[model samples]
Target: MAEKYLIGVDGSEHSRVALAWGLARAAERNADVELLHVADDSFLSESVAFLSEAQQASQQMLDSETAYAKTLGFTGNITGTAVVGHPIAELEAASKRVDLLILGAHSGSRFAGSFFGTRAVKAAATAHCPVAVIPKHEVSPGAGIAVGIDGSEASKVAIAYAAEAASMRGVPLIAVYAWMAPLTPGLEYLWSEELVEAQRSAAEEAIAIGVAGLAERYPDLTIERRIVQSPPVAALVQVGEEVETLVVGSRGRGGISRLLLGSVSHGVLQALPCPVIVTRATA
Candidate 1:
């Protein structure tokens, strides 16, 4: 069976972009797409005098979205569901039975914070499968694929998943490693040429280790290695501008100190122009 793409849409502009992206991807892969709109009763009180009218309006919106999905060439099997409850809960439950979950970073409302607001962040962190966060702006074609690695077990899993995706897409896999310099303030001025060369050599060696490991598993896969001297999030966003997808481990050597999604992952998801895939280390 072909993979199923589940997209969450809430009538927001960002969600509309996500719907388009998911449909396009489904069309390309010849897969089915499911459009879900969760209606939380908590946000809409039953005490309202026009509750019946509100429900009717919501149903009409869902019908229109369903029709829009069909117009986008999702002929295989397109479904639009309206459920009463929390948006994140509904989406998370739906993800358990689907191959992939595509979500919008943020809505157009001023109440919504960054791309990965509280709800989206929680859903992405605990979803059963891979979740791709789509940005709102129009993306150019052929952005390639970028993967972040830190020589940890979790990062190894991320690299494997990224390698397969890049191979399947027939695109170059850019393996990026971001490291920080020593704490010494005047290191460059104090250190001799030999020290600088040694540091450079060490950095190259670490990057080579990661590349060698990947090459052993995927001998035919084409990959490019980049070692940048900066924070992981900064380096990733700088290189991610030209990548179609950015794949990263849900948790890496940095561990959970940064929170459920981690600061770097959250930052990349918020700023990257392309879709960001956060893969589970165990799955």
Candidate 2:
């Protein structure tokens, strides 16, 4: 069966970017594309009079986005859907059947708490499949793929996904591992150079363990290892600025809940430098 990519479209420029990205990727994988637009039923539930108008508006959005998708010159199957419901709930439920879910990143006060903005983060956190959030701006020219590694099972899964993507794109893969020295308030002056070196060595080992099988798995792929002595989010963000796409696990070692996004993942979403892919290990 051909792979399928589900994209959430709201007729905004951001969603258009996501639609284009999804179509290009679908063309590469020979996958089908589905464009979905959901009208908030909460606002219309109280007024049955506006239900028809809302539905009509939703269908118009679907039609417009569908027309836009066609202009992109994608030859694959494209399906457009319009539903009256909660955007997050609809997208989350649909994610189960699709190979991947793609959305556009929207931030700032105008999009605050809306599905185009903060809700996208929530959807990524709870979606069953891997979610790719494409930013509005273009990525750095000639940038390669980058993934964060922290020795967690989730990070391991992310590494595998990123490696496959890099191989498919014929681009190099950069595996980044970041660490920070323990800063005990009272012992700040006792920190020594040897301790810093030990931490650095440990970070190297963690990255090594994180990418143990990449060389054998992806023989033609070039891998770059980055060890930074900073917070994981900061290091990944810096790498993101230089990469075409930044891939990260939905949660890391410190995450205990399956329904929540980890701090690092959440942080990167807030300050996205490029397209970000949030990968979750399948249960």
Best TM-score among the predictions, by candidate number: 2
Kindly state the number of residue pairs that clash in model 1.
2
Candidate 1 lDDT tens digits, 202-234: 878876776676666667678998988888999
Assess the local accuracy of residue 170 in candidate 1 as a C-alpha lDDT between 0 and 100.
70
Q: Which ten residues in a row have the lowest lDDT in candidate 2?
A: 107-116
Model 2, residue 40: C-alpha shift (Å)? 1.6
List lDDT for all candidates, in order.
0.73, 0.85
Native-referenced Cα lDDT, model 2: 0.85
lDDT of 2 by residue, 18-114 (tens): 8888898899889999988888787565576677778888888889889989999999999978887877788879998898999987763242113
Query: How much is the lDDT of residue 106 in candidate 2?
Result: 74
Which pairs in model 1 have colliding backbones? 143-243, 143-244
Question: In model 1, which runs have C-alpha deviations exceeding 4 angstroms?
Answer: 46-58, 110-116, 184-202, 212-220, 252-259
Candidate 2: the clashing residue pairs are none
